[model samples]
Target: MSTGITPSLFHILESKIGKRVLVVLDRSFGFEGVLATVSQNPPGIWLSDAEAVTLRSTLGNPYPQVTNRQDKSELFINLSHVLRVEILH
Candidate 1:
């Protein structure tokens, strides 16, 4: 992840409420899922249990293939399975 710029798509989700943006999650070694932002909760340090579950479901399934965007590559990981949340900016 890079510094001084937002990293987690969740944060981007929170920041861009009512706006549309691309969300990328790390599914595996290379696979990723791209989603269109539809809604978001207020800025917070953590996501609620319900939010986590909802995010997880959106991830669907992990893919063996990876995604390359903005010269970066990451897998699509389920947010519900995430252990920690970190901010880059």
Candidate 2:
């Protein structure tokens, strides 16, 4: 699996550290949190106070809802599993 750390993605992720973002995974799982770190050696994203959101599957469904409360303050997500990243204002 590709780490998904393209030059642009890396730059964008790096810049978003310490900021809020919505990370979308391959299976439509989402995480909304403050970006803690972006590792290049073993490409991954670390999120602080992250909330896992399960995306809606059927039409006319409600918006994604927070499904998992992260036990740890920091969450490390492998870049290979990241499908999309959206920086929040």
Candidate 3:
């Protein structure tokens, strides 16, 4: 039995492989990384060359600032905590 949605999801993910993406989590934090791989058993994603990022409004600047460009070699994100994903150049 299949709802016929999983393949489309996988296709989208596959197309994004090696591209830069921003993944926002349920928490206030998000990450920017290169899409490495995905695991279906537990519904998680692996990101290489990952960096932690957050958006915060500064006093002087009305626009939210992107901060915390901390570098990380690799990261595994549990899909349950993900809020949304955006493709970044």
Candidate 4:
């Protein structure tokens, strides 16, 4: 959880609030959406307008395919499964 930087994980995630982010987790499962809130009780994040992303390798495809999960408007990500979070522009 320690990134060797001065800022902690909570601070890092906090800085990303109100922005679009791509949160990558275990088994190539990712969530793409806007950061809605951060909580300590469950140590997770809530994403608004969220989409479940599945990263699959394809022949000759350099980029992974992204999916928009309209069925899931919001998602809660457990920090334990999180690998990294990419702040989207």
Candidate 5:
């Protein structure tokens, strides 16, 4: 995946492809929080605390990972792993 600064919308849409999405953990949000996505089933997914930790480590480490914000129990997708972002209503 390409690195650099991208938009949040790009990442949100990427989560739709059934590819394992790497969202940022929103520390501000509480556990069992929810996120918005453009997927056919846009309820998004949930990430456990352990999973969030793993994601954080994977980002800075030698892995093709994405960063995210964690809110206790909820995480948002990082914009880095967004390979191809599109705006489809």
Candidate 6:
């Protein structure tokens, strides 16, 4: 957690297009996937499964993992529910 001036989440997300990221929601849940697109009007992130990343649990931390289900191909996450976003290389 750097104390540098953080940019808007939207701009940060926009810059992550086509990259893998871990998005933590306010509810203590999160997912790892490739950022496909960003919506402004409604505010959401579209994640694709093409280059999906799986969440791993360590120690007692129960990290949410993405499954290979039919409906798991794409995920739409509301920006309002996002608490933090971490870019993965």
**Which numbered prediction scores highest in TM-score against the true structure?**
3
TM-score of every model? 0.23, 0.74, 0.77, 0.74, 0.23, 0.63
Give residue 68's error in model 2 in angstroms: 7.4
Mind giving the per-residue lDDT tens digits that candidate 5 earns over 1-89? 33444346446544544333334334222122223334323323433341332233344575333344334543444333333322223
- Collision count for each candidate, in order: 10, 0, 0, 0, 15, 0
Question: For residues 1-89, what per-residue lDDT tens digits would candidate 2 score against the true structure?
Answer: 56555778778788878988888894557788899988886888899988877665546655454455444466898888777788888
Report how far off residue 27 is in candidate 5 (Å). 7.9
User: How much lDDT does each candidate structure score?
Assistant: 0.31, 0.77, 0.78, 0.78, 0.36, 0.69
lDDT string, candidate 6, 1-89, tens digits: 33232348679778879998777773435766789999876678898873333445556776655432232577888777777777878
* Model 4 misplaced regions, further than 4 Å: 1-7, 57-70
**Weakest lDDT window of 10 consecutive positions for candidate 2:** 63-72
- Where in model 1 is the C-alpha error above 4 Å? 1-12, 16-72
User: What shift in Å separates residue 76 of candidate 1 from its native position after superposition?
Assistant: 1.3
Cα RMSD to the true fold for all candidates: 13.3, 3.0, 3.6, 3.6, 10.8, 6.4
Q: lDDT per residue, candidate 4, 9-87, as tens digits?
A: 7888888899998888854578889999987656889999988887765779765556434446888988777887889
TM-score of 4: 0.74
Which pairs of residues collide in model 1?
25-75, 25-76, 26-75, 26-76, 26-77, 27-75, 27-76, 27-77, 30-66, 31-65
Off by over 4 Å in 3: 1-7, 57-65
Candidate 5 residues lying further than 4 Å off, grouped into runs, are 1-16, 26-51, 55-89
Total colliding residue pairs, candidate 5: 15
> 70 in model 6: Cα distance from truth in Å?
11
Inter-residue clash pairs, candidate 3: none
